[model samples]
Target chain A: DAGITQSPRHKVTETGTPVTLRCHQTENHRYMYWYRQDPGHGLRLIHYSYGVKDTDKGEVSDGYSVSRSKTEDFLLTLESATSSQTSVYFCAISEPGQGPPEQYFGPGTRLTVT
Target chain B: SQKIEQNSEALNIQEGKTATLTCNYTNYSPAYLQWYRQDPGRGPVFLLLIRENEKEKRKERLKVTFDTTLKQSLFHITASQPADSATYLCALDLSRDDKIIFGKGTRLHILP
Candidate 1:
């Protein structure tokens, strides 16, 4: 319970369509991350933000993009949704110099691409 | 390339016994290792974090041990209960970057 919330907890879209998921947090954490979890692949980081207007790609950033215009929000976008991109996306937040430096996750958003 | 691996098979254990899960990595040294527990249809919850300098850490019935020399970490749950059954994930923070890498996770089942 990181005081985080993700919009559209469940979604369905068609291939080639664009989609965006929103993650909001009330913790005022400095670090926010987006990860997708799929069977056999585990959870792969798509992107992360260190601060407002500061972001970086992760291991699997090929078809995805992220933005953080405010400290309390991080958005993940699929420029062109594909069936292969279907996964349960999770949002996590961590505060620098915090107790254990471990990330706290939100509920998650399940996306299905047809 | 850096890689992290964990037992993919579900681990079955008897209630009241200790269940141990292993996480191994290669080609990377992490500043710390973290463990998370995930239930079905939910996001992972943070469990424990062990630094390179610390050999072990404990919280109640859960214990985590990190061995940088071996590039491995072990997570243990003592006096296991059916409620403790879930997928356990091990993660490592990149030494040179702010990113973190996670293992595939191991499913644990505590049977009565």
Candidate 2:
């Protein structure tokens, strides 16, 4: 219930195609992150943004890229999708100085690359 | 590299019994640890957070214990019910770097 939403809740695409997922937030949090969840590998961070135009790679950023042009929107793009990239993607927002830095997550987008 | 390990095996407990899950980490010092609950097809929801300096924290029937020296955290759900069955994840914050790491999560099944 964190004013966060991910577009295209579910999608199925072929391999080697470009795919992009969008995360929009109304909370105006300073930190936003993209993570992928798979069967054996819990949640692995893909990328994160501290502020508009500021982004950094996470542990599993090999096949993904992210960009943030405004505070409320963060985009995760897979230049050339692969079956290995099929997983549930989640977007989270956090307010650093507000409280415990606890993250609020969006509903999630399920992407399947076949 | 830092690693967090949670029991990959599922835990089954009878309804009304207490259920406890464990999270262990190595090679990193985190400032605080957190627990989250996730149902099938849903995003993780925050449960409890315990700081390194705090030995334990309680909310409702959930209790979380943090042992910085041991690099471990324990989550306990008292008087569990079937509705309590879900996957529980443990996360740690790398305070200095403003990043977090999560464990694979332990699934709990409170059978009635």
Q: Candidate 1 regions off by >4 Å?
A: none
lDDT of 1 by residue, B16-111 (tens): 999999999999988899999999999999999899999999999999999999999999999999999999999988764567889999999999
Global lDDT of model 2:
0.92
TM-score of 1: 0.97
User: Per-prediction DockQ scores?
Assistant: 0.84, 0.82
The lDDT values for all models are 0.93, 0.92
- Among residues 3 or more apart in sequence or in different chains, the pairs in candidate 2 whose N, CA or C atoms overlap within 3 Å are none
Q: In model 2, how large is the Cα lDDT of residue A59?
A: 91
B14-105 per-residue lDDT for model 2 (tens digits): 99999999999999889899899999998899888898889999999999999988888999999999999999999998644667989999
How far off is residue B9 in model 2, in Å?
2.3
- TM-score per candidate, chains pooled: 0.97, 0.97
What tens digits encode model 2's per-residue C-alpha lDDT throughout A62-95?
A: 9999999999999999999999999999999998
